[model samples]
Target: MNQRLKTIDLARGASVFIMIIVHTLWMFATPDLQGSSLFGTVIHILGKGTASFLVAMGISMALSRRQAPWLLAKRGAQLLLLGYVMNAAKFWLPIEVFNTMPESFINAYGWQSPLNSEQLKFMLLTGDILQLAGVSLVLFAVLNIARWKTHWIATLAVAIALSSEFVRGSQFTLLPYVSDLFFANNYQVYFPVFPWISAILTGYVLGRIYQQKQKDEQYLYKVCAWLGGALLIVGAAWLAVDFKGQFGNFFHLNGGGISYLIGLNLCALALLQYLFANKSSGPITRALLYASKHVTALYVIQWVLICWLMGVFGYHTLTLWPTLYLMVLVSLLTFAVHKLYLQSKRTTIGVMQKTKRTA
Candidate 1:
C-alpha cells in the first residue's frame, strides 16, 4: 500500500480528460446539439465521470501510509472549504470583478446582471464534487476510527444505494447547503452523498483487496472483469427498462447509474493497469501522471476558465465545430495556467524552505 499505484493515477487522468470534453460540451454546445448528436450523447453517457475521482481518492486513501483519523478529517475539512472557494472564483468573481457575465448566463441561472445578495449566496453555496470529496473523506475517517471491517463498509454502501432513491430530493429548508450535500435534487448540488458516497466506499473496499493482491495482477484483472461485467449487465438492463429512473436526469444518478459507473471505472482501471504497469515511461504516461498528480488543481482551473469565458461565448450558443474548437482552446489554456501555477508554487515552497534553513 505504501507503493504508488500508477494505474490508479492513469485511471483518474483518463477521467479528467473525459471531464474536459464533457465540460466543454456543457458550457458551449447548443441544447439541441447536446440532445441530438452522437458525440454529445456519448459524452453525456460518460457523464461527469466525477465518480472516478472519488474512486481514485478511495484507492489513494487505502494506499496512503498515514491513516490517522485526524489527518484524514483535516484534509476533508480543507477540501470542503476549497469547494466553496472554488464556487466564489468560478461564479462570483466573474459576476463581480470581471463584470463579464453575459445576459445569457444570467437568464439561464435566474440571476440578475447586478447580482443581488441572495443570488450571490446561491453562487457561493453551490455543491460540487469537491464538497462531496470533503464530506466523504470525513465520513470515511469516522468509519476508520470505528475500525469497521471492509464487509461492514460494503454493507453500508449497499444500504445507501438502496435508500438513495427513497430520499432523492429531501429538502432542508433551514440548511439548504446541508441539503445539497446529502439529498437535495437541485441544479446547485452536483454530487449528492447518498448514492455517490457508495461509489467511494466501493472503491475503498476494492482498494483494500487490491492492496492485498497487488502482486497478483491476474487476480486483480479477474475481479475487475467479472465484477464489472456483471454489474454492467444488470445496470444496462435496468437502464433499458427505465432510463430516467436509472440515471435521475443527469448529475443525480440513481442506484442503477451508479452501478454502471463503478463497473465502467473498474474495467477502465483493469485496462489501464494492464497497459502501463510493466511498461517503460513514455510521453503519454508521463502526461497522464502529471494530470493525475494535479487533478484537483486542474479541475478548479478548467472550471474557472469555462465560467469566465461564458461572458464571451454566452450560454449554450456554440455550434458543433465551434464548440469543438473552444474545447481545445479551453483545454490548452487550462494546462498552461496550471503549469504556471505549479511553477509559482514550487518557487514559493523552495524559497520558504531556504529561509527556514537559513533561520
Candidate 2:
C-alpha cells in the first residue's frame, strides 16, 4: 500500500478551511470586523490562507515531481490560465459587460454593481494561488535545470525574505498590493510569488527530506516541532519589539507575519504528523484529504456561492445564523460537486479506454 502523508493533507485541509472562512468573511462580514472579537480575530489570522495555501502548494509540488521541465511548463501554463479565469468575476470581465448582462445570464450568484476592468485589475494584480503555483513550478524547473539543490533553494528563500523588508514601502510609489505583486514593493498582493516563494521552497525542502529519509528513521517530526517552536518565538519577538505587535501588519506575508504563519503551520503539521503518522484514514484525515484534493474546485465554486449570496441575499452583512447555515450548505455543495465531477471524469476516461480497445 502506498504511504499517505497525513501531515501534508492535514495542512492543505487546514489551508482550505481557512480560505473558505476568510473568503466568506471578505465577502460577507461587515467592514471594521477586524479584532472586534475573538471570532473576528480568528478570522483575521485565517485570512492569511493565501500564504498557508502557497506553502502547501510548495510541498505538493515537491512531492509530485516528474523532474521534467516540459511537463512542469505545460502544467504551469494551464494553472496560470486558470488563475486568470478565476479572476474573471473580479477583474478580467468588463464591468459594463456584466452590468449589461441580463438576469438570465447570471448564475445562482445573482447580480451586483459590477466593477470596471481597471478596478478588477487592481484587486488581482498580485495574482492568486494558481498563478503563483505556475510561477513556482516554472521556478522549480529552472532550479532543476541549474542543478540547484535544496540548500541552494533554502538560501534563495532567506534572501527573498530579507529583501521583502526593503520593499516594505521605501522602494515603490504604487499601492502595496500592486507593487508587491509585480515587484518587491511591499506586501500588497499578500500572495505575490516573491517572498512567498520561500514558503513553497521551504515546503519543497521538507518534502525532499521526507523523500530521502529512511522510512524507519523517523526524526522529522521532532525537527519540525522544534523548528516550529523556534520560529514562533522569533516571530513573536519581532512583532513585539520591531513591529510593536501591530495586529494589522501581522497579516502581511512579507515580514514577521509570514514567519508567524509558517511557524504556526509547521507546528500544526508536526502535531498532525506525530498524531496521525501511523493512522491511514480517519474522519478528520479523510475530510482534510478530500478538501485538499478538490481545493481548486472548492475555491472557485465557493466564491461563486458567496457572490450569489452577496448579490441575491445581501449576505455581505451576515448574521450568525445565516453564516452558520451558509457554511453547512456550502460544504454540502462542495461534496456533491466533487462527487459529480469525479463520476464524470471516470466516465470520460472509461469511454476513451473502451474506444482504444475497440480500435
Candidate 3:
C-alpha cells in the first residue's frame, strides 16, 4: 500500500488556503461586509476547510501503518499540550502581557482592557481544532486497541451527528474542562468533539474502504463520485427546504449540514484525484504538497500572525480592500515564517546529532 496519498495532501493544502482566506475575513472585515456581502457568503460556504482537515486527518490515521496505541496516545498528548500553548500565545499574551489589543476591539467583544482571571481561563481552555483532534486521536487509540469494526465506528459517527443538536451548548460548570472539550457550544469551543468527531469517524470508515479499492484507482474514484453526488443532493435539498433548521450554526452543524460537508469533501477529493493523476509535478502542485506536509506548522504560524496583527488591523474595522490585501500579505508571511521554523528545527536536530556522534 502507498504510505501516503497525493490526493489527501492536495485536499489538505486546499483546505489550508481556504482557512487563510476565511480567518482573514473573520479577524478584520467590518460587520456589514462580513454579513451583507457576496464575498462574505462565499467565504462562509468555503469554511469547509476545518471539516476537510478533520476528515483528512481521520483518513490519514487509517492509512498509516503505525496503529500502535501507545504512539497514538503520545502524539495525542503532545497535541493537547500544544493546543494550550497556542491559546496562550494567540490570545493571552497579546491581550494581557503585551497589551497589543485595542480598547475598541476589547470593547467590541464585551471584554475589558485588562482581562480578568476568569476570562483568561476561558481563553486558555477554548476548544479549537487542535484540541478536538488531540482528544479524538486519544479516543481512537482506545477504539483501535479494542479492535472495533468499521461498521461500529460508522454507527457511532452517525449517532453523534444526529444527537449533537440535543446536547450542544449543554455545559457542566463543575467540569468546565471536559464540558468545553466535548459538550460546550460557546464561542470558546469552535470545534467541539460531539459533531466534529463524527466527520473524523466517517473519514476513518471511508479510508478503510479506500484501502481496499486503492489498487483499482478508477473504480475508487467512480464510487466516491457517485456516492458524493447522492449525499450532496440530499443535503442540499434539506437545506433548501429549511436552511436555519438544518444548518443552525456554522460551528455547530446539524446532521443535514454534516452530510453536506462530507459530500462536498468527497466530491472535492474525487475531482482533485482526477486532476492530479497525470500532473502531480507542476510547480503549483508541488507547492500545495509542501504546504500539506507542514499543515500543523502552517496553521500555528498563520494563526499567531493573524492574532498579533489584529492589534494593528483592529477587529472588524477593515473594508473589503484592506481585508483582501491583508489576506494575501498574511499568507505570504505565514509561508516565510513556516520555512524559517523548519530550517531552525533542522539545524537544531543536526547539532544534536553531531553532539551525539562526538560523544
Candidate 4:
C-alpha cells in the first residue's frame, strides 16, 4: 500500500474551505446586512487561496512524477482544458439568469459583453494554475534533461524572479493587450513566471528533501515548524510596522519582495508542520484531512455555485448574516459532492483491478 500524506490533504482542504467562505462574503456580506468589521477581516485573512492552491499543485507535480513525464504532461493538459471549460459558462450562459446583468429586455438580444481579453491573455500566460502546471511539467522535463542539477536550477529561478521584478511596469503601448499579458501591470492577472514559479521550485526542492530523508525520521518536522513560525513572526512584525504608508513601495517591490514571499511560505509551512505533528487522530484533524483530500472538487463546485448565486441575486443587497448561512450550506454541499466523487473513483479503480485479475 502507498503511504498517503494526510497533513498535505488537510492543508489543501482548509484552503478550499476558506476560499468558499471568502467568496461567499464577497458575494453576500454587506455593512447593512452583517456589519463590516468581522466580515472585512475574514476577507483579508482568507485571501491566500490562489497561493495555497499553486503550492499544492507544485507538491502534486512532484508526487505525480513517479509516473512517466508524458503521463504527467497529459494530466496537466487535461487540467488546463478543465479550467478553460469552467470559464466558458461566463460566456455561454444568459447573464440575466444569473443576475450578472440588470433586469432588462436588452439582455434578450443574446448580445454579451466582450470578455476581458487582456485578462484572458494574462491567465493563459501566468495566473491560471492549469497552464502553470503544464509549464512546470515542461520545466521539470528540461530539469530532468539536466539530470536535476540543483545549482543551475536555483540560478534559473532567481534570474527569472529578478527579471520579472525589473520588467514589472514596462509596457509597450503599441500592443497593449499582449504587453499586459507579458509585462506585470496594475492588473489582477498575476501568475507571472518570476515569483509565482519560485513557489514551484521551492516545492520541488522540498520534495527532493523528503525523498532523501529517512522514512522514520521525525525531528525534521519539529525543525521546520520552528523555522516556519519564526519566519511568520518576522514577516508579521515587518508588515505591521510598514503597513500604513508602504502600499506603493510594496506594490513596486511586487514579487521581488523576498520578505513577503518568505512570510507567506513560512506561515503555510508552519501550519503544515503543526498538523503533521498532531496527525489526524483527533476528530478535528480527521475532518480537516477528509476535507483536504477532496479540495479540488470542492473548489470547482463552490466557484460555480457562488457565481450562480451572484448572477441570480445582486451583490449590493447581500448581507453578512445570510452570507454566513449560505457559506455553510455551500461548503457542506461541496464537501458531500467531493466525497462522493472520490468514492466513485476508488470503486472504479477497484473494479478495473478485479476485471484484470479475472482475465
- Residues 1-359 of candidate 2: C-alpha lDDT, one tens digit per residue: 03446676677776777777677766555554533656667777666555556666766776774768878778777877776676665433323433432233223234334544554455455366676777777778888788888788878876776666655543355555435553433322445665677678777776667677863225666666787688678777777766643234543455565676677777777777777756757787778888877788777666655554454445346655565566666667757777888899999999999999999
Residue-level error in angstroms, candidate 4, position 233: 7.7
Which candidate has the highest TM-score of all? Answer: 3
Going through the candidates in order, what is the number of backbone clashes in each?
0, 4, 0, 4
Candidate 1 on 1-359: residue-level lDDT in tens? 36567777777877777788799898889998899989889888776566667777787787787789998899899999999999999988888888887778778886567878988888898888898999988987899899999889889987887787789898788976787789867878888998898888877887787778855557766787787787778777878887888785667888888877777777777776777765857887787888888889899999999999898888899998998899889888989999899899999999999999999
Candidate 2: clashing pairs of residues: 109-308, 176-188, 177-188, 177-189
> Which candidate, 3 or 4, has the higher TM-score?
3
C-alpha displacement of 167 in model 4, angstroms?
Answer: 2.6
lDDT by residue (tens digit), candidate 3, 18-96:
8888999988999899999998989988887577777788888888877899888888888989889998999887888
lDDT of 1: 0.82
Alpha carbon lDDT of residue 194, candidate 3? Answer: 82
In order of appearance, the predictions have TM-scores of 0.93, 0.82, 0.94, 0.73
Candidate 1 weakest ten by summed lDDT: 214-223
Q: After superposition, how far is residue 138 of candidate 1 from its true place, in Å?
A: 0.6
RMSD of each: 2.0, 4.9, 1.9, 5.5
Which of the two candidates, 1 or 4, achieves a greater TM-score against the reference? 1
Q: Which ten residues in a row have the lowest lDDT in candidate 3?
A: 214-223
Query: Which pairs clash in model 4?
Result: 13-292, 98-311, 98-312, 99-311
